[model samples]
Target: MRLPLLLAAVGTAAIASIAPLSANPEVELAAEDMLAPYYAKLERELDLPVAPAGAGLAEDTVLTRIGVGSCNHQSRSQHMWAKIAAADPQLFLFIGDNNYGDNGWEGDAALGSLRAAYAKQAETPELATFRKAVPMMAAWDDHDYGFNDAGASFTPRRWSETLFETFWGSTEEVRSRPGIYDSRIVGEEGRRTQIILLDTRFFRSDLEAMPYSETRPPLGPYVPSTDPDKTMLGEQQWKWLEAELAKPANFRIVASSIQVLTDAHDYEAWENLPLERAKLYRLLAGREESGLVLLSGDRHAGGIYTDTPDETGGEQLWELTSSSLNLAFNNTASNTAREPDPKRLTDFISEENFGLVDIDWAGRTFTMTLRGNQGEERVSRTVSW
Candidate 1:
């Protein structure tokens, strides 16, 4: 029998902040009333993971075009893949929640379900075709990482890491690291582009939820962590990130599985770990000459955001957040389905979509675009440092 997503997500303290009230009958009843169609859609998902498409992306490659997306439930339609493929990006970043492997299950069994989840995604014809055509990089978020909003306390994380390597390939530097964080410097010196994908779950501390009254959707369950002892990337990853930021590159795309610049939202983001968020800003601020662009996923919605923190001066720190390649919950009708973000520079997308970035190496400018299901640029921005 298929399990419900919310039930297993809150099965442990590791994910308590995501939905601590899952045991409440009223909450369950409300869920059923509001999202029955979403549940029905998940029930139809089958276990059918395809074989690995073989590793791609050479170290020497100079990528000017890249695609990004996350929060794809394998059981749903991947209609956006075709559009993303049509855009002809050289590399694609499948940032997080690549599949709902542990969505309705928990414990060791939840981690075990990842095998089939990876299989289901691989067998998807549209996704298969896209991967075969486009060289890709990936990272994991809550659901695909074994539980929703889970972190270091999760026991099955080590096992999940092994499975991730098996399907995504353990050839890169990530294979040697404890967490999934990775970096690549492509192109020659003058045109170097650095791609860094971070692992947000492995060593992250448990999140503290706000009072139950403020824990509802649209309100968000988490508040900025006041405990300075709490960590998001841990000490080792922090050292690694600092080293990566210092590397020579004309442009850098820092990929986080969660949002880094949005402090207004109470969801799972860097803002939830205030100290760590500030640390990241300082690291990037120390090196303002390197063109910086942030890529993030995990939110069901997608949008463009920018911030000019005091650490980084007046220059804008651009962040493009794209998500839910399939399972879109952004509804204009439901006030509870969405919330406001002061840093957002464009309208958020709740439907199937992907983000594409274009860099003009000679001109020293880049364009960030959110492409819709029909291959149209729904939102776009171009700027130079």
Candidate 2:
């Protein structure tokens, strides 16, 4: 079901030195009350008992169906999780904005806010059920990273990263690392699928905000930075990504929390770092035979984008953007202010939606589908490699 707009407002207050409760007691109690019926329904529907924490499908398991989406508010009703679970995707990718804990406070208050958001998500019956059914992988965006449109300068990033790892069950090795960027290969030899999760927030340079103008609406106040020194993935992560790309895999999915191929928009996207965008295009173009596809979330709308021969030197690149698992951007007229993309495979969907990618390994084909709350496919496209 669609939820009310729950975007976290940016706060400027500093955190107090005293430790606070991990979660607001009143909110926690209310959430439990609200989730009682849903949990009861879930218990009735699924005969199997809840699996132990971190119990999920194996890492090298072959995936036939994959679910993707972002921009979830922790307090909202996540009925969409049940719908996504029904789709039976072998893997679920939470690309970013997994929660809306946008508290600007540092120290204990910030930590407590982050903990509270994750606590709500963990306690949600639909999500808890979904986690038992499918394995999940996630990355962070601005809101969940403790601020709105945050970057390297966001001081509380280290704390947010630690909280993210704790909630998501990331390994100690990963937690000890610099950023959350990681890569994994699933399936065996001929049918392997490589999933690269990028950390866009950890080391990203500040975006160039455009001057106030009535013309900008959906695109926001960000302009493409011409500074050659600006970087998105940072030096170490860039090197790691290049190495990961060089590895063998039948198909590869590069997951980013922001749109990479849509440069016409003024919104926060890879376009804001033009040179980095070009580097990514070139990287994929160089590895054209690897069967590359981009999956991104952040825009609060769902759509598919493509880069043709001219853009990628004869290698066509496709990107599917699914966003707003609970909160959707329903105002379509306002989105018209952004420049139109000719490569868009379908019109932008402003309803609460999730993305599905179905791969037919033997047939070398895949279908990308966007589904609404009622479990109806709003848009779909099938392509063969």
| Candidate of highest TM-score | 1
User: Model 2, residue 282: displacement in angstroms?
Assistant: 1.5
- Model 2 / residue 121 / CA error / Å: 1.5
Superposed model 2: Cα runs more than 4 Å off: 1-52, 103-109, 213-218, 309-311, 331-339
* Model 2 score (lDDT): 0.76
Q: How close is candidate 2 to the true structure, as a TM-score?
A: 0.83
Candidate 2 local lDDT, 1-385, one digit each (tens)? 1111111122112323212211333433333343345434533653322212644667578878889999999888889989998898899999999988775345442446666777777777777778877888889998888777877655445556766776787767578787788788889878888889999998787788877777756657888997887889889888888888888888889999999888667778998998898888777777636677789999888788887645478877788999888888665344533446777778787788999988889899878889988889988988888
Give the alpha-carbon lDDT of every model.
0.77, 0.76
Relative to the true structure, candidate 1 has a C-alpha RMSD (angstroms) of 9.0
Q: Give the TM-score of candidate 1.
A: 0.83
What tens digits encode model 1's per-residue C-alpha lDDT throughout 255-361?
99999888767789998988888888888887635777999988777888998887665667999988778888755234223566678877777666789989988
